[model samples]
Target chain A: MAKGEEAAKQLPKVLVLRPPPMFKMFEKEFSEKFQFLKAWESPIPTDQFLAAEASSIEAMLTSGSRPVTADILCHLPSVRIIVTSSIGVYHIDLQECRRRGIAVAAGGDVVSEDVADTAVALLIDVMRRISASDGYVRGALWPIKGEYPLGSKASNCDILVICCALTDQTHHMINKQVLAALGKEGVILNIARGSIIDEKELVRCLVQGEIAGAGLDVFENEPEVPREFFAMDNVVLSPHRAVSTEESSRAKFELISGNLEAFFSNKPFLSRVNIDE
Target chain B: MAKGEEAAKQLPKVLVLRPPPMFKMFEKEFSEKFQFLKAWESPIPTDQFLAAEASSIEAMLTSGSRPVTADILCHLPSVRIIVTSSIGVYHIDLQECRRRGIAVAAGGDVVSEDVADTAVALLIDVMRRISASDGYVRGALWPIKGEYPLGSKASNCDILVICCALTDQTHHMINKQVLAALGKEGVILNIARGSIIDEKELVRCLVQGEIAGAGLDVFENEPEVPREFFAMDNVVLSPHRAVSTEESSRAKFELISGNLEAFFSNKPFLSRVNIDE
Candidate 1:
């Protein structure tokens, strides 16, 4: 009978969990354009409180950290869809969502390019000792060590890249075609899951002085490195952190907000995580 | 006349300190075609020993390490000119050579391209963390932490380069025009030697952060970097060691040998430390 009731009847009621920075834009636009309930707070209270207060909520917006767990899904029985702000759904229980007949969306490709760029940056920094040099400067040890160990020229050296996913995008980023154009003259160092590049392959290359050196951030197991690596003079290494950048974070937020808006409008979400066959 | 004396009168003696792997080719050709003495051993003992034993030595060969120092120059006073197979006279005392009026020759532009290529490689390596990541792989630690810091990209970032010379050769190696073409986004960092960089304009550009970072190998003061430089995060700093590479040792050896050959032939030396004014 009322203008607001008429609008609500035409649009879907939505609830957002841990909204990103750009959520404000989505809130302003969705409030005027569609029926939207943006619960952008954290430490969500008990299920009874949500069920009693948000019985009308039809869609839930979330991200990688605060996944829509089975318990949370049961409480939000009226919710027909879930939208995530990340590519990987490792956090969300897909089977639970399927049982509840809730649609899911995620953001994957939006952040891949930025991740690839950061990977290359990490590789170069490790090889050239940029961060170490920075530490030296901060320590006031200028003119540090033996002239930063001159590496073979990029154009003249070979480059080797070892990774699990050789998809179109990843292929484009590290393919031989791109490498040749970039004037790299080295072999690749891809071990499956970052675990295959054993100490032997690395030691052999370094000791024999075969193919200049390598750049790697992934490994077999994580957080545990061998002592022998620390002793070597010609290798560079870092923890698995190629995809975490400030830009990636911002992009992830934007994707999440966009997906939330589309879901609340009953429109086809742009980043559906699990599509029905 | 004695049987050997008649044959010896037509030949010249050449003393080679340490030649490159290619020296064997020269040995074969010169021995079969011309009369010459080639001493291939490194660390040629004492000056007195060389003078007494190699009195007939018409030419002396040396490299960066086995430089034809003023003392060595005095020993080989009969040697008309000196030759080196590499560039950079830091090891070979140019002042001493000038004081003695000795001519020196070196490999002209042979390794400039190579060195330049390596400089770019070092820049990429430092900026990208290549060595560190590779080191991690070798250490058996996969999935390196902080592998790629977010928002660290090369495009439109500031750069700084510090050097002591802006010779035509170095100018070509790290030319601002070329860098601008690559991505007009950085500054030059030169402080080691006056000859390392063009001083007048670099200061203005550095203050503005026009470039995201720098590649410094030298400084105005022999070892003292400016106090202001200690705070900048985007710049790459070194103690004037852009040219030190594993290949430099062999290149130096070859240059020294070339110098020895030219000194005996009464021809122009290869890597002259001091040219006739």
Candidate 2:
């Protein structure tokens, strides 16, 4: 065999259930370190693809949207570790991982600063009506309709910014009472998870003018937002892109590589999940 | 005369060309300190109104929208000070103020922090496509479009924020060469005067894809935006509201009152402009 092919054969193998977003950009660099068995690229069924390399593959990679279920775990008997390119591990079956003694590395503080920035952006966007007024100007209404109504003054705003982990206690923490307290002059900004706020109540509050406005990056059922939000100029909606930044993406790629390298060297995983919890 | 009427007659008289926006909110508080000679409220023409008060009015209040031209100053021969509720003193002729030895109290550092906050909001809004994507979601395009395009990463943006005073030398400072230097990946944000940038070249560059985008608050002319900009999703246009906030307005009011009080008391103006320059 040629030198490059021989060198590739000697590298450790990693099974990819599905390629992470922009995986092609990191493909060459990833290939230099380890061989990735791209399950999606193969024309075969996913289970059969898993079954073919079930005995040989010792590590796997996944993203936030892909679920690492118990059934998938059962198929990969030799898989000792799972690496994800997201801050949240809700998609992973931690109980099954613990039972199998498999280690899981997560996307941790790599996105912390980016998320904070998004929160600030959302807060300012909602309070200043940045998006709404931009729309007014684009709609060619500035000359005809005159000044867009003044938004809540930034220095005088009673604003709430939600930033917390999605836990049993934290879920649905911002409900009707919270909305009522926010009253007619307050704005809420959420770059955190959607379930943290009661969406139905939020809609009701907005519709009735209980609360002034909101900036939401995540929803209870993402890609399935309540249609009521569609007509509200006071609300700024994002496609769950709080952490979707190029720097964070590159940082995640580096972290995943580091985790795999540590696993191969028999060192402790960086940002390893405590499955016992 | 009644004691209250006599007391009001004894207070310092200040001429207001037109009641500033939201003047009613401040009227009661302002009346207690100064007796205002409101030009607009009078049935007479503006020059006639000014002529009537020319001999007695020693102080004048103006907003950014109102011009304190040489002709207006000529009509108000006894005016010793001009107080404006805006950061820019461009509406008042500095040379005329200098020639007449009349002090000009410009809106100073009170609005500095608010303007900075606005610049940040505009920067993040444009770079993240916050307003554009918000429009998509509000238009019910999110469900149909699958995903909004990823905006330029906040952490990897080549952004230029313009924050300088407008001057004869500084006019059209951001020209075609500067735009070319900024190149196709650059984004420009201007919260300063619109004339500081060559708006025509900016339009051409944006049309030809020579530069990435722009976020503009101030325009070359008041309330007259380039019509071509209405169609571009890459641009974010604000209606010259960078320093607008309830706090800033309050601060401006207090400063204006203080300046008038200082003029009558033989004290230094709180925010006196060195018009001799």
Candidate 3:
């Protein structure tokens, strides 16, 4: 037999839907353990390609951005496992997985520390006007405008940080009354999904001074943040990168490999999601 | 005897050069404990006011902005104690204080926590492009500009934080060599005095991309940051407010009062400066 045929026969058949960018860093290791069927790279349409060739695939690796809907799952009858390199598995149809008894594994707690750190950093930046003053200085406005205005004391001692997944139950979690209870002196720090909060209400509150300020790393429509948020000095914005630190990425890689290894060897998965509920 | 005269006789005379804003927060306690000779509030010239009225004042309370010069000290021969409501004593003449055997008290470690927090916040903001991206979104540029260029990973691990007082020996400590050692991925966080760094060399290095980025709270010139810094996205600027938190201000007030009470009662000061060194 040919060497390629021998290798394929020996390895587990795994489907990869829209491979993540970090996959390149671990491509060699993954390829050695499983023969991957790249659905996105196939010349035929993804649905047709999966229906024809991926029916025999027993395991799949994916990311948060790709949706593993019921329609796609219907084509792969032999698929028993779905492993995601993300903290949130909102993209995967959990109900369908639970019904089919398909095990779902996620990167859990790998991003908690980095996300918490970013939340605090954003809170400080918003309260102290660190980013605004930096912008003022960088814009050459400081030399002409004299001293920047004093920022509100960030340490009135209480702050709420929201870092949760966007599910039907969690969508629009932060509404007007929650913002009102926080008061004009309060600040909001969001490092979670944008859809978790009502974005329009948040904008209105900030504009009307119902809430003091905000530090956001996520938005309702990412890569398309509200235009109104751009004009306020009380807001500090980042490009949805609370978990982009190199250290966390490396940890994620190790976790993903470990989960895959555990699944193939018939051992319990490292970070398997409890879908029994 | 008159009630005013009785109160004056009972309270120890404390010479206050300039009342800080925080003094208002503790005015009642301060007035009850000591008879303050307010120099700034005096209609008479400061030199005449000091020589005539405050000569016999055994204790002096001042802030960082007030200069406790050799000339000021020469006017008040009977003054045995100098207590400043600040962490740094750069405005005071240490050599003259040593020669005269006068005890100098300062706010020590009261602000250390707050300053350290600010330093970390600024570092994260600069490295992650928090402020720059905030500006981009606010300027209505994000929609037109598409994507913000990715910032450098900034987490090569080691971070150098400078929170030292700028004295003759420590002035301009971070020169070109130090910046070079830090390399392109290194970030400098300064919540201390700006004079501690050679501002000109820092500007050159930042402009030439010699160092990754910087977060500066203090500047070489007060209220006048370098114009060049205003144009850079890699730098995060704060208006010398590393110790401006409300909690820290209260702590500073308590420390000042404790030091003064300790000195008056013939106990060692809580945060006495070592003049002999």
Candidate 4:
């Protein structure tokens, strides 16, 4: 056996879960170098799969879709590292990972600019009705009736943005710096994420019509949205899909691959999440 | 009277009609210096309002909302010039103005970049489904039922822009240079005005799906869009409303003001459509 193979066999088999295209690319790169690389299909139930694979697995790769659970961590006594390919670890039970002395790594800052660009694009599209108009044209509906009663004009309008307040970094990511840049020509709509914005202030602005329109992608509640938001025609809401870009996927995969590589080498992982443990 | 007032009084009265906010600003400016300035309501029909007013008018200030017709030019024997505050003279009969020796001036290139920015924003929104998601969230619907399916992200997707074929300058404005910049990450979708693009070639690219998606604001026949265009979901269409920004209205007013000032003094107008006239 090659020195790398023997070394990997002596350690633990690393199981990288299905990631976006970027993840796959990174996995391919790691697999070429590492002997014990196994990638699992996505949407695997944590309990069932972790129970079967935990004993032999030393490291596991995952994303937002396949969150690591406390129960699953309990089964994987040999697992020393948990790597997520995304910045947000809300899905991963970090406390449990810490208790088990598993290192964690995630993708961050690498994809922020791309996500911000997408957010701006999304805001402009919603304001201009670009997609609906495109839908009409593709359907052969020329002179798209009711499409341009007022027409798609941006210079006369204001814009609002609502985001989550989870951390100082996320706050700075979507705060006055970004908002002010966007607000030079339009109004801003930031509803607190406690770490990102203040809710009461945002509501006051919305209720008073301080902005011409708003673009919202996050909320305090996971699955619930405010009822008052429905009456406004100027607002646009997104269910927090802005950062879920292909670029993010690739960045995430790289994080996962790097974590697995570090764990087997008994070196500190790059994105170590539970450092205390 | 001041020299400006003396000149304005000697010239026959001109009625300049526009919407409220813009009209208010222009009226205030004109009323202070010119005795001939008469501001009227917008959306004035061709035959009754514009033609009737044209009889006594030496000049007419109009906007995109009203079409300055050949018949009106014919009726306005004293009319020396037709000044519009808009870049597009599509509503005015340029051929008639030239034939009748009626000078015409318009606003151009003042806000092309702004419009381009808006166009790109719309394209991103449609492709990413930003508005649809917004609607879902505002409606108190969480976990947006029809989320954008995970696939190739915008960075990976090709973009197409269908536009017109105008002057070499305008040609340059939306040419391969601009396309290369925007398409650095995607593709170009130009298919509206022959003045902006080559139709047959663009259609071929669309058919082949060389570009993953397109944003078409203008058409070859205009008002008579092709049937085949309706078949694609990846395409976004704007019924040629790309330039209808709030700034366009103000830009039009300034263009008209310059033309009017030039006509009364026999000085050369800034955007004189025909020097021969």
Candidate 5:
């Protein structure tokens, strides 16, 4: 037998629905342990590819961006386990996984410290205008304009930080009334999912100078942030990257590899998602 | 006596060379307790003003921006106390103050919390490129440019934070060798004085990409930062505003008032600087 075929036959199969962010960089290292059946590399439609590999495939790996819906799962009859390199499993149909008796594992608390650090960074960024003042200095305005205007004393302390999971109950939790109570001097920071805030109301509040400012990582319709925020200096915008760090990425790779190894060896899984809920 | 005279007679006399920042906001409130001898408001020269008011002025109030040279002190023989609304008293002649036996008061630990907050804010801003990403989003680059390139992941660890006071022994303490030691991935944050780091060597290091980046609040010269820093997105520049928050300003005002009141009442000074060194 050819060496490639021999290696493929000996290694356990793991289907990759889509590559996660920074996945390509670690592909060679991962290929040694598990033969990743890449659906994206196939010319056939995803459903056709899944149907062709139905009998052979028993587990899959996916990213946060791809949806693992019921329709997508229907093609993979023999699949028993799925692993995603993301903390949020909102894209995965938990009910469908539960119905099929399929197990799931996700990124664990590796990102918690980085996310907390981001929260403070964003909070201070919005409240103290650190980002804005940096711009002012970079724009060469300091020489002409003298001292940058005073920023709100954030350490004087009136702040709201959002880090809750996105759920039906949590949608639009930070609405107008809560914002009103937070008042004109208050600042808000969101490292959680964007839909948790009423973005429209937030835009209106910012436009009318009701709330002080915001530092946001995620948005309701991401990659399409509210254009109004572009002109405002008080607000600091991030491209949904609060949890992304080199250290966290390394930890995630370890966890994903560990979970896959445990599943193959019939051991207890690390970071298994309880799909019954 | 007239009503104004009656009030002035009961109030304590204090001399002001130039007003502290935000002085106008609290001028009326301050005037109620102390009779301020405004030298800047005089038509005569500052020396003439000081010469004229030498006997009546027992205490002088100054800001961080203005200098209190030995020449100025020569004209204020009766001035027993100097109260400055600033954390750093480098502008005041400490040796002169000591020789004349005049006690000096400054804006002490009031700004410590705010300054520390700024240190973290700048650190994350540079490491995560929060400000740069905000600018990219604002410039409408997200859709066209795809994802903003990944920042160095400041939470990935390596960092240097400079928060020590600048003294004769500490000037240019963070020179080329230190920057070299910090190396390619290390980011440096300076919330201390500008002269503590060799600005020329820093510019060379940054331009050559020897070190990762910097977050600077103070500069080598007041109102004059090295022009090279303006172009580097890795650097976060602040116009010496780490201590200018409103809450700290209020604290500073209270401290200044307390110090002046104590000096007049023959009581212990608050935040008195031991200028013997």
Candidate 6:
């Protein structure tokens, strides 16, 4: 039989909404088990392609920052399950999924430890000026610049460490006054989603010396950080990869594959998320 | 009274062998208790100055990276005490101090926590590609480079963490074979003195991909890093400042002062190092 004919003999079709950039590494492995309907790769528009090709698709895969919105879900009437390679379902229309009775599975507790480790790493890098001094040494400015500026202590103070999800209400929660109260010696560390803090005001605070420094893992427009931050020795920038160690990536792949396999086999989902919220 | 005479009358004479750059921040406070004969500032040669002026100097303050050699110690016949603003005293001639029965006080447990924090920070920075990505972001190459290269996982492995003083025997302990055993994915972190590792071999291993990455706070040479390391993304360089935090510095000031006070007052030193070693 031809390859397409053999592929048609696979299990239930799974629509993949914007697979992660790295998903291609595991694409062949996943495709061997289930036929993937690539909505993003269609020559036609997504909606028309989904309606024409994925109308009978009962399972879908979402990974990275792809938003599985209600409008898109309107086309997937047969989607009984949505398996994501992300721990957070904020990108998915959870309410719509609830109304549609679509079971949701997330990339469970595997990433929390890595996320916590990244948070601490960013914190120390900011407060101890590790990344900045690293820049100085790398830039060959140390012999000329003398001592790189001293950074404030990370502990033994009233500094607050808050890590939470960035919902509508909590968006832009860390505004100017909040940073002001944090004071000149205050350090802000953000490992969560960047929209939680007002990035513009954060830049302003950091530039004006209203706040001391920051260690940022995520930005409002990721991969497009402000140019102002580039020159500042006080800020440390990390690409939005707090939970992206090789170990974590392997764990994520296993969990995602397991979830898809479980869904197809009609077994209990491994890491089902409550879609009711 | 003249400034020198008045200063001499007000405080007990204590020689300072290369005072820390930040010592001036606390120098006035320290000077209230002990008259510091600045060896580095002497017009005559250091040996000549020590023989003519500091022969009667019973206490000496060493900070930063100044070497208190056996030859230098020969000039100080009356030296009974030495106080340093560092936890590591590889720069000081311990055998001579032992033979002379001179009590040496060092920055004690106060720096251990900060040093450990730095070690962890460097490890995570190297393993997570934090510093490299930070540089990429700063250089405005993220948009062009796409995602930064994935880094090796740091934990759940047979990772060895060693922090110790650089002694004659321990110098060059981490040579090519040690690094080779660490393999292509191992990461080496140096927060102690630089000579402990064969830095040339380290550079060669890193360049040849024999070992994965390194995070070096101290180098075989200070303020002068290898030009090759300047271009490498896998390496993170810090200017020998693993124990430098504003909070720790204040604690250090208190400890150094207390040690000096204790030594002068004929009380047991707060952080006296065992010179018998």
- In model 2 chain B, the worst 10-residue window by lDDT is B148-157
lDDT tens readout by residue for model 5, B202-272: 99999999998999998888678888988788999998889877887778788888999898889999899
lDDT of 2 by residue, A162-274 (tens): 87867678789999999899889889998878999999999999999999889999899877889999888889999888886677777888999999999998998888977
For each of the candidates, what fraction of the native contacts does it recover?
0.37, 0.54, 0.44, 0.56, 0.59, 0.70
TM-score of chain B of 2: 0.94
Return the lDDT, model 2, position B44.
85
iRMSD in angstroms, per model: 6.3, 1.7, 3.0, 5.0, 1.5, 1.4
Q: Candidate 6 residues A1-277, lDDT tens each?
A: 9977676676667888788655776777776777778888888999999889888888998875888999999998899999888776778888899998999998888888888888888888887888888878877888887777666666643354547776777789999889889998788888878888999999999889988788888888878999999888778898877878777877877788888888888899889997665
- Which candidate has the top score in DockQ? 6
Runs of candidate 1 exceeding 4 Å displacement: A1-16, A19-68, A78-83, A98-104, A126-130, A133-241, A244-277, B1-152, B158-165, B168-185, B189-195, B198-212, B221-231, B239-277
* TM agreement with the true structure for every prediction: 0.56, 0.90, 0.78, 0.68, 0.92, 0.94
Q: Kindly state the fnat score of candidate 3.
A: 0.44
Cα deviation in Å at residue A168, candidate 1? 22
Pairing residues by index, what is the TM-score of model 2? Answer: 0.90
In the order shown, the candidates' DockQ scores are 0.22, 0.55, 0.34, 0.38, 0.60, 0.69
Q: Give lDDT: candidate 5, residue B125.
A: 88
C-alpha displacement of B180 in model 4, angstroms?
16
As for TM-score, the candidate ahead, 4 or 5, is 5
Candidate number with greatest TM-score: 6
Q: Pairing residues by index, what is the TM-score of model 1?
A: 0.56
Candidate 1: CAPRI quality band: incorrect
lDDT, residue B208, model 2: 98
The lowest-lDDT stretch of 10 consecutive residues in candidate 4 chain B is B176-185
- Mind giving the per-residue lDDT tens digits that candidate 4 earns over B123-235? 66545655445545655656556334432355566565544435445643554444444432455544335346544544555576544555667765565666655655455
Question: Which scores better on lDDT, 2 or 5?
Answer: 5
Arrange candidates, best lDDT first: 5, 2, 6, 3, 4, 1
lDDT by residue (B1-277, candidate 1, tens digit) is: 9966666656556566555333454555544433444454424566656676565555554554455666766666666555554454554556666766656676555555544543554465445444434444554545344233332444435554433334445643544454454344554444324344543234434556544455554555535566555555445555444454345534654555555555555556665554543
Cα lDDT over the full model 5: 0.86
